[model samples]
Target: MMLDRKGNNPLLAIKFFGEGIRWLGNSKLRKFVVIPVLVNLVLYAVAFALGYLYLGDMIDRLIPDWLQWLRWILWPLFFIGFFIGGFFTFTVLANLIASPFYGMLSAATLGIAAGESATVMEVPWLRVVKAELRRAAYLGVRAILLVIISIIPGINVIAPLLWALFGAWGMALEYLAYPLENAGILFSEQRKLIGSVRWGALSFGGLAAAGLAVPIVNIVVAPAAVIGATLYLREIEKK
Candidate 1:
């Protein structure tokens, strides 16, 4: 499990993510991935179902009759937005609900990555919940700000790019939290650690976000992300 830490290669994150998928096949790590995958499957299925049912109505409401011609252009953008938004939103909720399991998964992955036995660590449910709440609040406030910017006059033009970056950064923070917390790193410090390797972290998160946008692929991406984040942190610590 020795990771390649040669240079500050942004694509290294992607390799770690792939390593995560490969690690899922490891018998020792297989058990740790199950619950998170199931949680993702259920949450995403429901979210996609609801989105499918209401997406048409939402699009109609957003575009007036005079702008009917714009539907052809805006429809795709709206669909992409809905997909990314729904994925990130449900991802946060899923991670919150499954935080305890994720904690154990991260610990076990760390153990395996270190060439040790896969030991399930005890999860402090209360603390994990509180941490998740803090992260949610942090993300929520920023998300609201982004939404406001999205609706502003000229400044709104770059909103989509902003959201894309935010989503990538958010995904990095979301997955990286488990291992960082297990290592006794606080939320504030975790941000700094991620910031230190911003591009690599974002690459990992961006690819993860992209993978989760797919249908069946999204189901396993959560657990894979957990493993990937663990690997990413391990490499960061080595540096």
Candidate 2:
């Protein structure tokens, strides 16, 4: 996976996802995808339902009867609030619950990339689960800290952009950690390798962030992202 750590192909991140989807026809990889997809779908459904319901209630309460004329403003605000809230909440919760399985999927995909039989690769479920939780907790803490920063007065204006940057970087770190770990690389080394191709990782992660923001399409984003990150790692190794 670190064979070409310096290769900076910015499009590779997104290409991994596209190719991963295409690679699913291979059946073996598709098997790894099923559980994560199901998990995402269920989590996303519940998240969206609850988020919008809460958003609707909040809007109704906030808008005054005289402000009914501001329906246009309130409607868009409702949608924006729901999407933002649901995006982070749904993604965080889904990933947290499915962390171990995602590691398994990533390891299997790494096997496929190495031309090794997926069955031959022994996925340590316990280790993977613990690692995933740690990664998720790390991300969650950073996000919380950023949200806190956004609450500050002078810097509040750029908080959203800052959060987007964090989101993009988090996507890269989160997804890539799977294959890197499978290859026995340390998280510190993974960060350095990724930093060498920082822009490419950003492109990859930014695209992922965008995908996760979409409604129904986001259901497939998790597995697809893992596939893409795996493919991207393999691609770099060949360089």
- Which prediction has the highest lDDT against the true structure? 1
State each model's CA lDDT, in order.
Answer: 0.83, 0.76
- The regions of model 2 sitting more than 4 angstroms off are 1-6, 52-76
Report the C-alpha lDDT of model 2 over 1-239, residue by residue, as the tens digit: 44464446676566676876676566887767788788888876776677678867876898888877787876788778767776777787787677667777777777777788884345576776677667677788988889898899998989989888888888888787777777777677888878877888887888888888887888887788887887787778754
**Candidate 1 global CA lDDT score:** 0.83
For residue 231, model 2's alpha carbon misses the true position, in angstroms, by 1.3
In model 2, state the lDDT of residue 4: 66
RMSD of each: 4.4, 3.1
TM-score of each: 0.83, 0.82
> lDDT value for candidate 2?
0.76
Model 2, backbone clash pairs (residues 3+ apart or across chains), number: 2
